[model samples]
Target: MKPTDYINEWVNRITPYSPGKTIDGMTKLASNENSYGPSPKVIAGLREKIPEVFRYPHKNLHVKEKLSEYCRVKPENIVLSNGSDEMIELIIKAFKGPIASIYPSFVSYPIYAQIYNREYISSSLNQDFSFDHRKFIKDAWKANLMFLCSPNNPTGKVIDVADIEEVAQTGKIVVVDEAYFEFYGTTAKHLLLQYPNVIIMRTMAKAFGLAGLRMGYAIADPELAEALKKVRGPFTTNYLAQEATILALKDLDYMKKSVSRIITDRKAIEKRLAEKYKITPSYTNFILADVSPMSSKEFFDRMLEQKIVVRPQPKFNGFEGNYVRITVGTSEENFLLLDALSKV
Candidate 1:
């Protein structure tokens, strides 16, 4: 039999996720990575704990208690994952139901469906990239799992809590991926007390500058958190990641400053780039701009040639060849990108 016969039908049909390329000495702004470096405390903590690698991580993962303090939830109400992507996969693996999310959000949501062989569904966003709230509510009733990406990836649009609460009130499982929560400044965690169905997923990768460490966690009802733990690996969270995340969370002021700096730079870049490219108000660390007169491929190629990289938009969903997502880099890096754009 051919190799085709060995492949599972669902896995074969799903397209794999392609991450942005990394090049040495390139002014990288494509992947939405935090431009700011990690906190002093995080670096120090990681170094101090380096000698402890000979042993397995603490069995209970008491870092959950620290996370509980930061998130204002009890330890049992939280579940940690290798990264937010793993959390999404685990949820789909653990729960048995129809999964639904908005189109053009995080691309990984659909991949998990193929891996677990679960039902996956998506509702397209409006032309302006806003959700059709009425249609979403109607669909929520039928779906058992709803994956919501607030401060959505690529588009950078924020979701209203009122809209989320509407679906949560219906008893549908609403997993809000607030991976960009630091950038957005609001969360659905508050609704969890009344709505046991609300599952808020946050990551240390963005604000904490621990993307390399790969730490992400979910805040959910205590019972739901327990169920997710049953599907999670005993030590999916590494010792370094857990330790660094705790240090980062405790040094809140340091992270807050980094966040403030990125936000300031985002606005500056938007104002200058808006003269040529149409930009939406970003609630996240990246800005999506309409770069017409140049195809997405052409723009991406030109930027790469100049050693300044930005994200290219594919014509998936309703996107044409005119849009590109640019991460909000440091002021110097942003200037370098703007200068490269001028040359292109």
Candidate 2:
């Protein structure tokens, strides 16, 4: 009669996600967070809403309305979640059949699939880490739900809209994670109009700099949106998050300015890193470097010695050689990162 004996066998198979490490006084470029931080208006709004914590969060109609206006979709076509992570799980819960995605993209697609005991399938990215839509479609033929990340995590490469439309043609539920859409202005939202099964997941964590608030949303056809709403918890998004997100949406200029800065810094880092390592072209706030001569672990350790933190990509299905993901930080932080790399 051990508690372990009662745990589901499938749940036991899952390897938990390991987040980026945090250490005092280190320049953190491991996690892809917006180092610029959230807008002052959002902070003020959160302060005003603090006294109302005694009350339960409402149905989130206002938040959805505001998001709808921002996304240019009807309120009924939107569903709010604690973060896009929750939305991924909700999509798993609300759908049936195997989950499919590109190998070595977002780790959560397969992680959540395992949590729910759904079959998971994947297609390998090309040697250069570029996606091959035709190959993926054929490989994922058995999947009924597919997840695609644009300006994909770690690599920061974007999936072209034409490729996404090719996947959507299969009539499977297609979820395009646009977490870094602000950095790369291209969007697959136009596909949503033609394909009722297409869903676009977004978050305020990046350009809006509200990673602490964990606010995210999805835009799909009204019927599909309603289904997701039913599967999610009633109060997953709290009042503070709602208020803060509303304010963030209203302050688009602030978000754009931050994105512009990150984009500029991202290019600078890419240019500098390319002088040494093989740099992956990025459309997001991070760059993935092929530190081939040195093991990723060794590179991480060297960066650590310099009081800098960078993410070492674990061996995923299609990844070869050693690679590290470096988030674009503030100008000072980037300078420090470059200086540290010089020493390494």
Candidate 3:
């Protein structure tokens, strides 16, 4: 074995998450990111906080207080992280067992399992790509961690609250990622009151448009929340992010306007794309379409040729190479992609 063979067997097996490819002057719609920016208040918040950057932000009690009020969970029941991704990693470390998630969902769930050298388990989605809890109910009992993405990535299907409760009943710690919660208009956070075992993961990326700031958090049983803090260590949430998110949460109007545009545009794109291809109606800010006239790879290349970037879901678990996920962008950006698809 070579010197690098010192790596753990699981680490050796993991394929790291690939970000959407970047190209100069391209209309990007691959990462499911909100094309809108954070509240204008964030700019002022940053300017006010920049002078204090030299000081380490002590535990962010004030920010947690704001999040608690927003999520309607007690402050002690929350654990803040750099992003929802960090919260997932912390959950893996704290739970320290096999990671299970619905397949062709978020690719990162299995990737997180590999990074921590934990077992990764999954069950395929229905042929329509919608979730069905009955398929994995038995396997869930065997798992220590369960990552459920509501308004699921790529597919944009939001698992029903009843479906989430069924998985929570299996006794595994259920982490419901609500990264696109604002778009969907439903939350499993109510499950927290019913199930002590549930963990609702949230981020400021999608609706709040704070992806660059890396602010995400979780709401869980107070005991589990405390455990996450121990695993998360210290200072992962830097000063600017903590303050900016607090401000962003206060400006609900900005989020509403941003989400409104995406939802409106999502329907518009779905309507247009449906005329030519099979497209999934979505709750999140993206649409998954079957691009059967061309291989996903060919379609991706075709879009790139038009200076647009879209995600081909075949790279994700359970996809069979005829699907692509297109993010809902600004009107002009969406028009560019739609126009390109018409020609391609």
Candidate 4:
């Protein structure tokens, strides 16, 4: 039999989730990465900590300590990982739950759910691509684990706190993925005091400008937080990534400045696009644009030819047809994207 036939059923059945292109050879606005590189101090910190790479990393040390202080939570309440990607995978392995998430969410949830052979349920977003809390809560109650993205990926719509609280009351473990939190200026950290079952996941990749470092964290009650320790790969985080994150935390001012720029540019892009393209108000660093004039395939092809990459919404059940997710990029890059859109 072919190697494909011998592959695990779930693995063979899975359709890989597509990610945005690398910026190396293109005007990359496809992946929603912070255009501003890692905090300047992070570069300096990595140089200073280069020697730490020779020895095995200390189990619990400065990075976790500094992160806890920054997050205003106890060190015990945080579990750092290679990046938020590892955190998501850990959540799937640690919890035996019927996985549920709102549609047009971070693509990884369904990927991980299938990997674990768990029941994965999905609810659709509203027509405007905003989350409908009533449907979310209704579906969440039946799930053991639910992934909710704030300033939701691709769509860029944020759910109100009142609705988030209502869903938290569903009494299941609610994993809120705030990958784009800094861009939006909203958070679910306050909900942690009231909901013990809530796990707030934040990525250094998007807002902190540390996507290259691959570091992220989860905040939860210490008991529940510790449960994830089993799946956490010891030494999965490298010395450089740890050093970079600590420095990024120290340069909060620099991080905030970059975040401010992204917010400003996001609004500008939204307004310009809305004048001609069917664009929605995005609170995050990306916008979901419906290019119904062209078929989704044609839209994708045209953008690729222009060397600009954007995500196409998959036509799964309720989600159909030509919508592309455009990430906020630098002034020059955004202008390049505009130029391409103007032509198409």
Q: For each candidate, C-alpha RMSD in Å? A: 1.5, 1.0, 1.6, 2.0
lDDT of 2 by residue, 10-95 (tens): 99899898999999999999889999888888888889889999888884899999998998889998899998989999999999
Model 4, residue pairs in steric clash: none
Which lDDT tens digits does candidate 4 get at residues 81-123?
8889889999999987899998878889999898888889888
lDDT winner between candidates 2 and 4: 2
Model 1 earns a TM-score of 0.96
Q: On a 0 to 1 TM-score scale, where does candidate 3 land against the true structure?
A: 0.95
How do the residues 1-344 of candidate 1 rate in per-residue lDDT, one tens digit apiece?
Answer: 99889888888778898987778999989888887878887887789889999888773456899999999999999899998989999899878768888888898888888788878788888777887778887755567898989989989998899988877877888899999999889998999989998899999989888888888999999899999999998889888888888888789998899899899989888897798888878999999988888888888999999998888988756655388899988778988987887888
Worst 10 residues of 2 by lDDT: 314-323
Q: How good is model 4 by TM-score?
A: 0.93
TM-score, each model?
Answer: 0.96, 0.98, 0.95, 0.93
RMSD of 4: 2.0
lDDT of 3 by residue, 288-309 (tens): 9888878889989999999999
User: For model 1, which pairs clash?
Assistant: none
lDDT of 3 at 137: 75
lDDT comparing candidate 1 with the true structure: 0.86
Worst 10 residues of 4 by lDDT: 313-322
